[model samples]
Target: MNTQTLEKLREKLHDNANILGNLLVETFHYIGLFAIGAVTAWAGALTCWEMLHQGTITVDDILLLFIYLELGAMVGIYFKTNHMPVRFLIYVGITALTRYLISDVSHHHRPDMGAVYISAAILLLALAVLVVRYASSRFPSSNTPQGANATDDPERAEP
Candidate 1:
């Protein structure tokens, strides 16, 4: 009822909430890792089955397989590094889009719309990758020491 009591109660609630949020995050992290492992296993098995039965792998099929591999790799990297490499994922997405465009264009008589859309997506993803790479290089992280001449770090050498 008193202001001091209320403040203490609020702090306690805040602490409790933080603990609960952290637990939820950890739970989701584990779930994500498990799902990734399961999907990777399934994809591997499916690829093997297709290879055994069909005796031949097509370009489109290989591209789809690569998508699955990228997804699994992304998950693995997240588990190991605790961070996702956006640039690498963009590359994967570009490849997937290109592969889709190629496959669909071959089968359809007029793939103008699909081709344009896929091409635009590929271009946008490429731009994103370029931007991220440029930003990362220009403004390096703490582990990366900027040259002395760099305006951001006065202590570093210019050359």
Candidate 2:
């Protein structure tokens, strides 16, 4: 009935709304990640099966499978630590470019600039991965607010 009681009730209601919103967001996030992971794994399996049924699997097919695998791994890491490793993406890029190079060479009877460009891309991606690794280690994020890397000792990161 008093102004103080009314103010307390309003604050409580606001706090409850925020909690409910956060809970809903987290639930949806998990659901989406699970769905994506399941579908990617299924597709990878299906592709492998189709390749086997066709009676031949090339190196490019194998590399394509690795992309699917990396995607699944990225999803798993997200589920486990809620942090996506940038390195995984870089690895996928490298694999994809290598596959492109293989495809161009196999499809074209003669060596072309397309294959050369793909090779260059792969090299650049590999170097980018190394640079990212160096930077992360050299200037590691000591304060992980989410506590995801709580066990990671910055001192042990020194090579």
Candidate 3:
């Protein structure tokens, strides 16, 4: 009887530990999401504030703001469908690369050949975004149940 009681106690302890582990993991996940959201918001605000202080909004500032916007959108999508869309990152990259080209042209009377490289990079990113969009529409997720999200692609799903 004593041995049976010990076994029961061990099983209960193991079950409780598993539950606690899950709770902790969930808590950390939420905390991380909140941090990403809060930081993106803060950065956007700072960018705006800097533009105000400068008394003019430069293309660079606008591009920076767009990056923040993309980050926020990525976080929001992750929260909603638990999926991270790579196309947003590609969009952000294209914008950033274009911004670099603009910066080169604006700051330098004779823009260096580097501008060509950046433009090429932007084109690549744009192509990547198109490919991702095409792939997503062409091959939809098969794992989605009725009323369930199909945003998380199998290639991107966590193990």
Candidate 4:
């Protein structure tokens, strides 16, 4: 075969390889996401069952459920948009920290500095969420689609 024909064939092969690689990656990506969603749902269901068996709902249990809810929402949003919401993770962190703080205070007869530290951490996470929201709204990312959330795109996410 002539040099031009061989070059053309090589280019076509390269293009096809790239397409196949992208398809493979996308397939695995979706499968992993579905697995995560399933696990979250299963865990949440088990937690609910345990709560029902106990016959009493505690504050900690409610907070745990909220954490699970946030995780499920995060997973669903990521599955739908192909982007993770940073705010949901922050909300989870805040909820988890609040739960810990409450549990510690109730368990311990005397309050300690650890509780204060956890409160501070929750405040920081809340501030982070606010900052992210403000930045996304004030300066929409160029790579983000029109009318879409800028924060949803990792490229537009704050460092």
**TM-scores, one per candidate:** 0.70, 0.84, 0.78, 0.88
lDDT of 3 by residue, 126-146 (tens): 788777777765666565554
> What are the lDDT scores of the predictions, listed in order?
0.75, 0.80, 0.79, 0.84
Task: Give the top-scoring candidate (TM-score).
Answer: 4
Ranking of all predicted structures according to TM-score, beginning with the best and ending with the worst: 4, 2, 3, 1
TM-score of 3: 0.78
Clashing pairs in 3: none
Candidate 4 deviation (Cα RMSD): 3.5
For candidate 2, what is the lDDT? 0.80
Q: Which ten residues in a row have the lowest lDDT in candidate 1?
A: 150-159
Model 3 segments more than 4 A misplaced: 1-18, 146-159
Better of 3 and 4 by TM-score: 4
**Model 2 spans > 4 angstroms off:** 1-3, 142-159
Candidate 2 lDDT over 52-111, as tens digits, reads: 999999998899899999889888777876777787888889998888877878888788
Which digits, one per residue and each the tens of the lDDT, describe model 4 over residues 1-159?
999999999999999999999999999998988898888889889989999999988899899989988888888777777777788888899999999998998888677899889988999998998897788678776657787755466534553
Candidates ranked by lDDT: 4, 2, 3, 1
Q: Which residue runs does candidate 1 get wrong by more than 4 Å?
A: 1-6, 108-117, 140-159
Q: Per-residue lDDT of 24-121 in model 1, one digit per residue for the tens? A: 99899989898877988798779879877999877787787777777776777667656666765776898889888988887785788769988999
Off by over 4 Å in 4: 147-159
- Candidate 4: 10-residue stretch with minimal lDDT: 150-159
